[model samples]
Target: MPTGAAQRPSVSSPRKRRGRAGLVLLGLASLLAIRIWVMEPAVVDSDSMEPTLHPGSLVFVFKAAPQLSGIHPGDVVVFQSPQDNSMMIKRVVAVGNQTVEVRDAVLYVDGFAPDEPFVDHESIDGTHFSLRRIPPGEVFVMGDNRERSIDSRDFGTLPLSSLQGLVLGAGR
Candidate 1:
């Protein structure tokens, strides 16, 4: 080498570059798999869940939750709207074969009113729904903000197959 000449910087070999790229691809694939079969993030787009889940709230939806843990009354869940196929979030009020009714703004399951502290009763406007029996494979869901939410009262019961996931928790 000539005196005063600058030395060239070391370059990564092709094998090393390929290895790094392969690792990145593997990591991405793992994330995709988890999202598809395990869990995913969802955004609440309406005030239907009000005190429990507000509009623009970010929540974690565990896709495998239903399989691991049975869904019951008071559980928040995500599903497709039967009317327009849009995504919706609501709390399960009645399970399969359960009779649900709302009289004078009070919710009744199997003729008994369950205490729901999360409900926005002030927003309820004398809503009265006749008794409806949920099918063996369906659930009745409703929004905490009843007056503003279009839920089972409007669309009837939702099949368990339509449920996308269970809302585990909220995020900032």
Candidate 2:
């Protein structure tokens, strides 16, 4: 009995709008869950990792896995500082069972030079140092700004348990 104009669909009603809003809320909740249970946010506060990560850079760290095989060399990670319990970021230069040495400011792992293009500064002292067979469950970490960092060279190797997470990269 209604004309074509009268039969036309009306604007979305309040009920329909509520349903759409609910879906949006659900999506946001899912994202929040993932962030809380998996990745965590970290803020850089020093130039220790300069040329790679600078002060004020925001990054996300993936929580350490329960069954991690081992931390590999070249992986940027966050850990508790040995000198102090404060969290610090550094790159793994040597893993357990591997040897690390710095000779005349050049880094050598197991007698071979690593391709460390990220290092932007020479060691402050430019001296020689070595660690033979870093004990199991430990890693040697160093800062890209070697000249200004207090790392394995200063505090020695850190226990794997000290590591909190692996830095994936910068965030937007």
Candidate 3:
């Protein structure tokens, strides 16, 4: 080698390169598993959850939350739309075996109305729905913007099996 010449860096061995590629593949597989069984990112596509979640908003859905903490009324969840199997986000208003009704645009569950500060009641008209019982293993859901949302009121209660995850939070 010439004394004043710069030395070239040695190339990594083929075995080392293959090992690094395997590690990269393993890392990617782990991430895919986590997204499938732990958490996932979803985008809101409608005004259904306005005042809480807006169109184009990004949200994280915790897929294991329901199994870890159980589903309850007032919980925001992601589920498959019964009509088209498309994804949707909504709040659980009535759980299994509960009776639900809407009178004068007010929601009543099991003969008592729960406080819904998230709902946009100003846009609601004289909506009246007869009482219906939620069957075991099913839940009734509604959007915060009830006036513009097509939810359980239109499609009826959904089976718990249709639920995909719980909304942990939203991002701008």
Clashing pairs in 2: none
lDDT-best of 1 and 3:
3
Q: Which run of 10 residues does model 3 get worst, by summed lDDT? A: 163-172
**lDDT score at residue 38, model 2, on the 0-100 scale:** 69
Task: Specify the poorest-scoring 10-residue window by lDDT in model 2.
Answer: 62-71
**TM-scores for all predictions:** 0.85, 0.77, 0.85
Candidate 3 Cα deviation (angstroms), residue 32: 0.9
lDDT of 3 by residue, 42-159 (tens): 9999999988899999999999987888789988999989889889999999999999999989999999999888886778998988999999999999998999899999999988
Q: Pick the candidate with the highest lDDT.
A: 3
Q: Select the stronger candidate by lDDT from 2 and 3.
A: 3
Displacement of residue 92 (Cα, Å) in model 1 is 0.6
Number of clashes recorded per candidate: 0, 0, 0
Candidate 1 Cα outliers beyond 4 Å, as residue runs? 1-18, 170-172
lDDT values, one for every candidate: 0.87, 0.81, 0.90
lDDT of 3: 0.90
Model 2: per-residue Cα lDDT over 1-172, one tens digit each: 7566656677899999999999999999998987876678999889998878999999888874413645689888888887878889898999889999888787889999888787743445675786467898889988888877789989998888788878886211
